[model samples]
Target chain A: MDSEYLGYAAGILTTVAFLPQAMQLIRTRQARDISLTWAATMTAGVFFWLCYGVAKQSVPMISANGITLLLLLVILFIKLRYQDSTDTGEK
Target chain B: MDSEYLGYAAGILTTVAFLPQAMQLIRTRQARDISLTWAATMTAGVFFWLCYGVAKQSVPMISANGITLLLLLVILFIKLRYQDSTDTGEK
Candidate 1:
């Protein structure tokens, strides 16, 4: 297989990995168990990957990280929102 | 900054992202909320990245993916173990 194809394959696999967790969290409205630190760190990491992708002009990295970053952001938002509710006993 | 440095930087950021979650899971023995699908998918994805790294002979990719794969495997193990105990009441 071509190197580019391999890169895309890897990207797709990793990028899609977040979907199940994100969907489950959205469906169940449960984010208290999810670590905010993990979400935040992963988001920052994905952002760096996006920057690296742009620097290298790599389509796979740019596209994959772009979508992954969005997903992580949503997760982060849910985590924070639910955490706040739990902490304040508002939920 | 050099492109190589950017790749390493990206790798480090993304790779280290898992540590917080892993440590939390280990310290708290809580894996009930972690999606098995996510763990499985990510493990597979990191494996592909490892393969891609080998094919491309990229040091950063190889090193980062290698370590990430191990961490994901541990996470998968914890998820499975806890999930089984929860299901069977063995824990």
Candidate 2:
């Protein structure tokens, strides 16, 4: 019932939400078809969330967004790298 | 400087972040490598965020997560369907 607990719960839940996509991307190493617009948008959202968390000094927000950002970054990188390679026909 | 503007800014940013990924997935119609676990986890997070938003009566949180939940649902559905089709080998 505590606010802290509530925030933590939210953090954990949201973090896990990203797991399915993250795991899939990591395993396959293919991100060519994913939407550049969508990923870019989400990254912006996470960045704002991180900033908001900092501004509000909300630990839950900070932790959750930080981790989400990292996960997203990985996905984004895979997507870009895959596209780059495919375009170059390196693999 | 208003809180409303700040919240909206965050929402837009995060939403845009997901743009790239969403676009890629939609264009290629490929969700084979995405992880079920990660998607489930992200769903949970969004669910909690929705709950928290409701409890707190935070319009910004509610709006952002509501849209996010919908987007994620689409991705999840595509992934499942793709797997099902691949399993059946009808395509």
Candidate 3:
């Protein structure tokens, strides 16, 4: 029961944490510091977490990972946009 | 069985994702794009995840969250150091 609370709390915290980062990218329009590798890996990772949640039938995980995956996709989209527009490299 | 593999893969990818960001920070020494809010929130979230892992007794969660926590702390520490030297403002 306690661990369930902890899981939910942890999931909520981690899930919401990306909001500011996504907002920051929008606000500053700076993706120079955000590595392409990082975004790609996180996207894959979060996607898998979502699958894990679905397989395990865990609501907190499903919701948390789902929301965060969406946020991460936004982040990746923004980062790539910036990359394509400004920076010139493999990225 | 399949989901277990997915879980580990997810954990590993997410855990290692921070590496590039950390390396970028180290290489560029640029904290301008790095947000204090992002760092702080992520740190708190990851710390909670670590607690959750301990509660759940999941090796993948524990190891992944633990290593990522250290990397995040490093990211936060470096960001703070840069903030102190170069920038002035709350957070």
Best by TM-score: 3
List the pairs of residues colliding in candidate 1.
none
Docking level of model 2: acceptable
- lDDT by residue (tens digit), candidate 2, A1-91: 6554555787887775566576667776765545656666677777777878887888877888898888888777777776543322121
What is each candidate's DockQ, to 2 decimals?
0.46, 0.48, 0.51
lDDT of 1 by residue, B12-74 (tens): 888888888888777766575578998998898899889889999988889899989988888
Colliding pairs, model 3: none
Q: What are the per-residue Cα lDDT tens digits for candidate 2 across B1-91?
A: 5554655787777654544555555665666555666666676777787878887888877887888788777777777766443322112
Off by over 4 Å in 1: A1-5, A84-91, B1-4, B84-91
Worst 10 residues of 3 chain A by lDDT: A82-91
Stretches off by above 4 angstroms in model 2 are A1-6, A84-91, B1-6, B16-27, B84-91
Q: Write the per-residue lDDT of candidate 1 for residues A1-91, one digit (tens) a residue.
A: 6876766777888999888888877775656547788888788878888988899898877989999998889888888766644322111
Name the lDDT value of residue A18 in candidate 3. 90
Winner on DockQ between 2 and 3 is: 3
Question: Alpha-carbon error at A20 in model 3, in Å?
Answer: 0.6
- Estimate how well candidate 2 is docked, as a DockQ score: 0.48
